[model samples]
Target: MSSATNSQLAIRTRSWMFTPATRPDRFANAAKSQVDVLIVDLEDAVQPDEKAAARGNVRTLLDAADNTALPPLAIRINSLLTRFGLDDLIMLLDAKHAPQFVLLPKIESPEQVLQIDTLLTAAGKTTWLVPMIESARGLSVVEPIAQSCSRVAALMFGAADYASDVKAQPEALALQLARCGVAAACAQAGVLAIDAPCFALHDAERLHADLTFAAANGFEAKAAIHPSHIESINTTFTPSAERVTWAKRVVEAAEKGAGTVDGRMVDEAIAREARRVLAAA
Candidate 1:
């Protein structure tokens, strides 16, 4: 891909924040927040009785479009098996504006991704997709799901629901294998891997540690339930000034034919990493 395209995708999802479609006022508030992506959730955030109203509200917000003042918009539609899923797609089909992305929850197979892709194609929409891997079946076939459709920009690891599905604790440590699996799949597919939220909203220390671990394990971005967490998540995923400096030095040394940098052996792989860091920075 071209440098411009790579840069666009890199900066597209550093801090993804979700706002309920039922609360249209919050959409404007979230748009102005520090989040890089704003997702208007029509799924779990809305109650059963409010599903229809939430869809209408989201459509109204889309009709009065303003991409300049808003972050990249996405909508988390309900699962295909759910009663509200078809309705969500129908609404999007007739929308005056299209979201930059659409997040599909509880994805289990490539066929599911293909189905959405087909529908969007038929509707003449070019929205990208972010598939949520939140179940054992979904985790097991994440690689296929990531590679299923060309429009998949990222694969999101949904921890809480995955934990419930597997009857495990919602802690990161407990879900380490699943998280790493997702990261590896996205990497192999050359797409982004988004980490799940740290549900302990009050525990800043835990959140920091979780985000750090996620970045170390290969997640490109993280989702946040509250705006308070956006700053930290964005900061954590971004290369720090010190790290950027070191990467530049390493690249310089490698170009000079030096095999060592700060006492560590430098090779083609390490040099490539340095270049990636600078590009991302």
Candidate 2:
């Protein structure tokens, strides 16, 4: 792909901050923050009876035809098997505008992704998708789901739900395999891999360690529950100045067929990575 197109992909996969659908009071603040995407949740964040009202809030955000101040918005809707999920889909289809992305939770098969894509296409909506793999079944189908459709903009690893599905504590080591699988699938499919949020909101040390681990594991972005975590997540994912300089040098040499940078061989694969790093920067 051209550098312009690559830049678009790496631009805003850094920090995704989620706000409870019931909490419209916080929506404006969340949108104004330095988050890459502001996710309005209609799933776990809302109580059963309050789902309708929560959906209404999401629709209201969509209804604002002249609001250019909103950030890149997304909605984490309930599972397709649930009634609320159906309602969420209906609301999106019936709305005047659609969120740039939709976080499809508990995705276990490519068919499910296809179903949503088909529904959106039939309605003439070009909304992209972010399929969240948060269970054993979901992880097992990560490759297929990542490759399911062009509408998939990214793949998110929902560690909390996956750990619960496996009856284990949500530790990094225990969830490493799933995280690796997700990252690999995303890399292969040319989509962003988003790390799940750290639950220990008060443990600064733990959050730092988690961020370090994720940045080294092929994850390009991370989700945050609180605004406090946004800055750290963004800093961890942003390519360093030194790295960006090296990437530029490498790509420059590769374009001229030098195949060598600072006495290191720059192959096609390495050049591609350099391009990605430049894009990320």
Highest TM-score model number = 2
TM-scores vs. true structure, each candidate: 0.92, 0.95
- Kindly list the per-residue Cα lDDT of model 1 for residues 1-281, writing each as its tens digit: 11122355645578888899999888778865779999899998999999999999988877875656878788999998887998998888889988988999999999999998899989899888899999999998999999997888889999989999998976646599899999999988877889998888899999988998899998988999999899999888789898899899999989998778888888888998887678667
Angstrom error of the Cα, residue 260, model 2: value is: 2.2
Q: Candidate 2: minimum summed lDDT over ten consecutive residues — where?
A: 1-10
Which candidate leads in lDDT? 2
- The parts of candidate 2 lying over 4 Å away from their true place are 1-11
| Pairs that collide, model 2 | none
How many residue pairs clash per model? 0, 0
lDDT of 2 by residue, 208-243 (tens): 998998888999889999988988998998899999
Candidate 1: stretches off by over 4 Å: 1-10, 251-259
* Model 2 lDDT at residue 74: 85
